[model samples]
Structures are given as C-alpha cells and as structure tokens.
Target chain A: MRVLGVDPGLTRCGVGVVEGVAGRPLRMVGVGVVRTPADADVADRLVLIERGIEQWLDEHRPEYVAVERVFSQHNVRTVMGTAQASAVAMLCAARRGLPVALHTPSEVKAAVTGSGRADKAQVGAMVTRLLRLDAPPRPADAADALALAICHIWRAPATNRLQELAAAHRRTPTPVRIPKGTR
Target chain B: MRVLGVDPGLTRCGVGVVEGVAGRPLRMVGVGVVRTPADADVADRLVLIERGIEQWLDEHRPEYVAVERVFSQHNVRTVMGTAQASAVAMLCAARRGLPVALHTPSEVKAAVTGSGRADKAQVGAMVTRLLRLDAPPRPADAADALALAICHIWRAPATNRLQELAAAHRRTPTPVRIPKGTR
Candidate 1:
C-alpha cells in the first residue's frame, strides 16, 4: 500500500510518500516540504498550502494519507497554527476521497525508532537506514513526515484486522435471554 | 458594501450577510447556521464548512468576508475545532478573491455594543436593533455573525484611512541627516 504522510505546519508542511506494506521493504516515492512565507497573511498562507498539497496529491496519488495529529498541549504559540495546517491537509486528502489517518508524534517515533521518546536525530537516522537513502531527508520535519508514513504502513494491517472483527461483531445478532418472570 | 460574516464552528457554523456602510441603516441580507453531525470526522466537518461558506458567498456575492478570529485562549476542548473551521472559511473566501477580515470577539462586541466585554445577549439585542428586525437572530451564533459583518463595515473606513497613511509614509523618502564628523 502506498501512503502519503504530512507533518503539517503553516511555515513548512512536510510531505512524503512511501510505498510498501507491513513486514516488507518500503520505497520512497517522493518527499518534500511545502513552504509558505512568514510575512504572508494567514488566509493567503492557507491558500498557498492548499495549492501545494493539491499538487502533491495530483502527482503522487497515494491510496492513504497519514497526518501527524496535533495536540493542544504542545507549545501554546504554535499549536493553533499546527492544528489549522493539519486541518487543511486532512481536508485536501478527504476531498479527494482518500482515507486519512492521524498518528501522534510519539506513535511515529516509536514506530521508527522502537522508542516513543526518541529524539529527532534518532528518527532521522532510523528513516535513513530504513529507506536505504544516502542521508536522512533534510529538515527534521521531512524526516518526521517519512516516519509518519512508515508508521501508518506498519500499523494499518493490525488496525484493519481489528476493524474487521468489530464489523463482524456488529453483524452478529445478540442472543436473547429470558427473564425468570417473563414466562 | 456587502459583507458576509462567518462565526465558524465544526458543529454549527453561523453565517450572515449585511449590506450598508458606517453611520447608515444596515440591511440583513441573510442569516443562518450550517450544521454538521457531531459524530462526523474532523476532515468531513471542514469540507462541510467550506461548502457552506462557499454557498453563502455565491448567494450574496459579498464584496468582503468577515470571520471571527479564533484564539488559543478559548475553551481547550473546542478551540481547535473552532480554529479549523475558521481556516476553512478564510480559505474559501481567499480562493474567491474576496478580501477576508478577521474580527476578534471583543472587537465585535465593542463595535456592536459600547463595551468590549458585553455578553452575547447584549450583542444579539444590538444586532436586532441595528438591523431593525422584529427579533434577534436565533442560535446566538447567527447574531454574532451579523455583528461581525456590522463591525467590519463600521471599522473599514478608519482602517482604510490608516492603511492609506501607512502607504503614503512608505512612499515618502527618508530625510538624510549627516552625523557629526561624517560628511
């Protein structure tokens, strides 16, 4: 399965595409950052981001899109921007009818480095080794984006299995139990 | 001038259109709320908001769009949703080449009533009185949206004048003064 990962930010939204499934070697289809000028108005910046993301979507056409889920507990000043940017990314993916998944920072880190508390350098190193690239993707954001994609690819199988089980359970009728006084 | 005001929220996005200038009788062109299911996913909610805002813009053909500026200081649980919805509203307006203006809640209240700290009821009452409507707009959010449009219409004149002065200042050359011992 091919997946596009987005590490959303107003100033620099990182995007990367990874192709593979669980327990298999992955290939880096494409990776880059969508940069918006800091001096631009917020609305204009969002427009730029939308265009950039749309271009990426048109070029890569991944089956699933994974985005870093933002939490308000992060840096107070930047949390709002992150949330807004993530929303834009998700909206773009959803508009195209692509399934979108949100993974937390720790989840991405844990998937890549085998530790939830791994540092940026560790994530970068792991991505480089896993993708067999000469070097890690430039900018920590880019590495994080790749990590998100890898995480989604590795976790999807388990998630799908659990969903299937839930569906089966829902389809099964609940057995009726008669109360003692109900005749 | 015609302005479409948006009080954005994931579950209930309030939209209203007002036509008039400062110190004149304002007309309420339209007022309503675009609601999404509470259980809907975030990305879907944003799409709904974008569609709703676009419909309002197409119907009213407003010269300007006013959206409530979301701040991080709001209720923690809902602020993110509010921010995301506002982004979609702003994005839709910007994409259509309509000038988008963000008005803070305090600014809207101050423009409608005389106090920045005025409660929702006061602002709603003022919006009703100003629009000469028999009753205030329902759902408080709709009234708040109308108040936003009114605020923008009232403040645009002063803001334009200030912008003009700033532009003039930029156009003016700075006078050179020689320092002591420097020819």
Candidate 2:
C-alpha cells in the first residue's frame, strides 16, 4: 500500500510518501515540507497549505493518507495551528476519496522505533535504517512524516482485522428469549 | 460591506450573512447551519464542511468572511474540532480570495450586547434587535454567527486603521544613528 504521511503544522507541514505492506521492505518515494509564512493571515496560510498538499497528491497519488492525530494537550501555544493544518491535510485526502488514518505521535514512534517514548534522533535512525536511506530525512518533521506512513502500512492489517471482527459482532443480532409465563 | 460569518463546529456549523457598514443598519441576508453526522469520519466531516461553506460563498458572495477565532484554552474536549472546523471555513473563503476576519467570542458578544460577558441569550436578543428581525435566529449557533458578522462590520473601520498604521510604520525605515566618535 502506498501511503502519504503528513506531520501537520502551520509553519511547516512535513509530508512523505512510502510504499509497502506489512512484513515487506518499505520504499520512500518523496519527502518534503510545505511551509507557510508566519506573517501571513491564518486563512491565507491554509490556502497555501491546500495548494501544497494538492501538488503532493497530484504527484504521488497515494492510496491512503496518514496524518498525525493532534492533541490539544501537546503544546498549548501551537495546538490550534497543528489542528488546523491537520484539518487541511485530511480535507485534501478525503476530497479525493482516499482513506485517511490518524496515528498518534507515540503510535508512530512505537511503530518505527519499538518505543513510544523514543526521541527524534531514535525515530530518524529507525526510519533511515528501515527505508534503506543513505541518511535520515531532514527537519525532524520530515522523518516523523515517514514514520507515520510506515506505521500506517504496518498496522493496517491488524486494524482491518479488528474492524472486521467488530462489524461481525454487530451483524450478529442478540437473540431474545421468550419467558414461559409471557408466552 | 457584506460579511459572511461562520460559527465553526463539527456537528453543526452555523453561518449567517449580513450586509451593511459600521454606522448604518445591517440586513440579514441568510442564516442556517451545516450539519454532519456525529458518526462521520473527521476527514469526511471536513469535506462536508468545505462543501457547505462553498455553497454559502457561492450563494452570498460576501465581501468578507468572518469566522470566530478558536482559542485552545476553550473547552479542551471540543477545542480541536472547533479549530479544525474553523480552518475549513477559512480555507473556503481564502480559496475565493475573499478577505477573512476572525472575531473573538468576547468581541462578538460585546459588539452586539455592549458587554463582553453577555450570555448567549443576550447576544441573540441584541442581534435580533440590531437586525430588526421578528425573533432571534433559531439555534444559539446561528445567532452567534450573526453576531460575528455584526462584530466584523462594526470593528472593520478600527481594524483597517490599525492595519494601515502598522503598514505605514513598516514602510518608514528606521534611521541609522552615528555617534560623534564613530563619525
């Protein structure tokens, strides 16, 4: 599965495309950051982000898009910006009917480094090694984007199974027992 | 000046359009809510918001789009959704190259009711009074949206002056000072 991972931010949105399924070698197709001027209005900045993400979608045409799930508790100052940027990214993917998945920061870190608390350097190291890259992607955000893509590719199988099981359970209706007295 | 105001929310996004300048009477062109199913995916919800906002823009073609500024300090649980919804609203306006203004909740309340701490009912009542409506718009969100538009219209003059002053200051470069010894 080819997935485009987005590490959403207002100032600098990191994007990376990775292709592979679980239990297979992953290949990095592209990596870059979509930057917006800090001095620009938030609305104008969102328009720029939309254009940037659209360019990436046009070029990569990934089957799925993975975005970092934003939590309001992360950074009090920039949480709003992060959430806004993520919204633009998700909107772009969903507009094209592409499935979008959100991975928590820790989930991406754990998927790549085997530790949810792994630092940036650790994630960078793992992404480089896993993708057989000559060096880790620049600007920690870029590496994190790749990590998100890797996480989605690796976890999709299990997620699908769980979803299937839940669906099956819902499909099976509960049987109602008739009381002898009521009957 | 005509303004389209948006009260962004995931489940129900309220929108209203008001046409008038700061001093004169304002006219309510339209008022409604764009709703998405609670069970819908966030990405799909955003797309629905985008479409809804686009339709409003297409129908009204307001000179300015006014959106409530989302603060992270607000309801922690729903703040993220609010931010995301606001982003989509801004994106729709900015894509059309329309000027977008964000009014704080207090600002909107104060503009209509003369008190920043006014309750929803107060704001709604004032909005109905200001617009000469038969009754307050249905749904608190819808009334709040009209209040936002009213705020933008009332505040635009001062905001423009401030922005003009700031721009003029930027244009006027600071003179370099040379000490006698240096000279």
Task: Indicate which candidate wins on TM-score.
Answer: 2
Look at candidate 2 and give me any clashing residue pairs. none
Residue B129 of model 1: what lDDT? 97
DockQ (C-alpha based) per candidate is 0.62, 0.77
Candidate 2 per-residue C-alpha lDDT over B1-183 given as tens digits, one digit per residue, 9 for 90 to 100: 899999999999999999999889889999999999987789999999999999999999999999999987768869999999999999999999888889999989888888999999899899999999999998999999999999999999998788689779879989989888985
Where does candidate 1 chain A have its weakest 10-residue lDDT segment? A158-167
Considering every candidate listed, which one attains the maximal lDDT?
A: 2
**TM-score for candidate 2, residues paired by index:** 0.91
Q: Where in model 2 is the C-alpha error above 4 Å?
A: A162-183, B165-183
Docking quality level of the chain pair in candidate 2: medium
* Ten residues in sequence with the least summed lDDT for candidate 1 chain B: B158-167
> In candidate 1, which residue pairs get closer than 3 Å at backbone N, Cα or C atoms, i.e. clash?
none
